[model samples]
Target: MIYFDNAATTKISENVLEEMMPYLKENYGNASSIYSLGQKSRAAIENSRIKIAEILKIKPSEIYFTSSGSESDNWAIKDILNKKEKNHIISSRIEHPAVLNSLKYVESKGIDVTLLSVDEFGNVNLDELKNSINDKTGLISIMFANNEIGTVEPVYEISKIARENNILFHTDAVQAIGNVKFNLKDLDVDMMSISGHKLGAPKGIGILYIKDGTEINSFIHGGSQERDRRASTENVASIVGIARAISDASENIDENIEYTKDLRDYFLEKLLNVDGIILNGPIENRLPGNINISLKGVKPQTMVRYLDMFDICVSQGSACAAGSIEPSYVLSAIGRSEELALSMIRISLNHNNTKEECDFVFDKILRGMKKFKK
Candidate 1:
């Protein structure tokens, strides 16, 4: 199968799997326990935390592991809202459903939210983001890179604005972790969320980087896990796998970027000549691994089904919201019409994707278009 759905999730690497095996088998002890086996597990978890912090150039104490990106996002958003009542939230409309849904829930709780609009190229306006913040603004949550369209937001600039306004900033970097360069210290973000599956680690594990001294209330209140911020037994095996994946990805990120960019450009070049094809995001500033396009007159679901028949994998929108059949808010935020949004398909690549697979997908898309034409 030609897999082009890296944005949804990535296949875990063999190295990561190898690193996780011992934890799953003999070292399966609760991290909070005081016994030898538990101490060993706890030590491994702390070491992995340190490694992840090194990779992101942040302090190990600042990193908190979560169940997934959604949980991390929820914790960040809800903590802010709970701590400061009647505060305004600034976020882009193109954010992943995790952030968008969290903001929606916050709004339902009587918190004012400003869903900032993106330009046609899927770029958020810096001025608009700046103007959205006021004394009542508590937090600004934006995505590092768009999952569907691949457009990289000006997160550094937005974070700076948030800092100047004394509002905390958070970014959902789930799709950007392995595909883009990220330095938590360099960016003025107060918190960031990352999912392991998006970076070739096992699913159901994620990281939340909360800058030191950032005030956040507890989400899951039970035990003293995650510094009492979140209460759950740690997924030790998955955490090990995530740390391994992050380390490996960081070491080879430059090569991955170059290789994927070549494949992405080649694929786009082949499809650009096709009739009624519109690229959804900025051509240059977007992620090298992502290519979102709308095929005029063809519904995204139809194209997805056609591709699936050929053993090709792709997505119509964010996998979290796939079954809804609703037009993607990300596309809509970028000024795409409802019909165009419905017709959009995202093709995300990974280091494992080959030139041959790209060619096959191109041919399949062309054939699918011909059938649609008839």
Candidate 2:
């Protein structure tokens, strides 16, 4: 199958899998134990943490592991709210459900939440963000890049705003880890969340970066894992997998970005030849592999299934919200009409895809559109 829905999740790298095999086999001792076998597992976990820390230019103590990006996001937002020091938070309307839902839950508990509006490009208005802060605003959570539309946010500016106001800043960088390059020290955000599955690692591992001395309550309570902050047995194999995967992605990011962007532009040029196809998000600052578009008078689910029949995998919206027959909230936040929102399809790419695959998928899409002509 020619998979175009890489934004949902990517295949695990073969090298990453090979590196993880030992941990899954003879090296299966618990990381929390004190025996030699356990020490081996502990050593692997710490080494992986150090590797990831070096990539982000942060302290190894600052990185905490969780099961997924959703978990990391929930921990960052909920734990801060649990601190009870702030009753107000700010976020964008186009954030992934992980952040949006967490904020919604807190809002139900009488916390004031200001979901800033985005422009037509799904970018948060920095002015609105600046105007929303008050003494009670203790934290600002925004995504580094959008999953559905792929618009990269002004995170450096956002970080500066939060610092100036003494408000904590957290970014869900699940989609930006491999697509956009940034060092944590330069960006200077208090917290950032990353998912291994979005890049080349396995699906059961994620990381949350909390800057040194940043105080937040712990949601998980158990054994002394993750410096006694996140309590659970470590998934040693996946941890090792993610460290290697991220290191490889970081080392070759420039080459990957050029290749994917060029291929995506070529595909868009061919696909937009058809009439009444409206592209979503900004053309210049979007992710290298993201292409979202709307076709009038057609249903996105129908098109998705049609492509799947030809072994071409695509998506209607975020996989987290799949199987819900609703217009995309991200599209709505960006001022798209209900009809256009319901008709949107996302075609995310990766370096593994080729021109021949794009040509095949474009031909199938042309036929599908012709079959459902308005």
lDDT of each: 0.89, 0.93
Per-residue lDDT over 319-360 for candidate 1, one digit per residue giving the tens place of the 0 to 100 score: 887876788888888889988888888899988999999989
Q: How accurate is candidate 1 locally (lDDT)?
A: 0.89
Q: Provide the lowest-lDDT 10-residue window in model 1.
A: 78-87
Whose TM-score is greatest here? 2
lDDT of 2 by residue, 155-207 (tens): 99999999999899999999999999889999999999999999989998999
Candidate 1, residue 263: the lDDT equals 90
**RMSD to truth, every model:** 1.2, 0.8
Error of 1 at 193 (Å): 0.3
Alpha-carbon TM-score of each model against the true structure:
0.98, 0.99
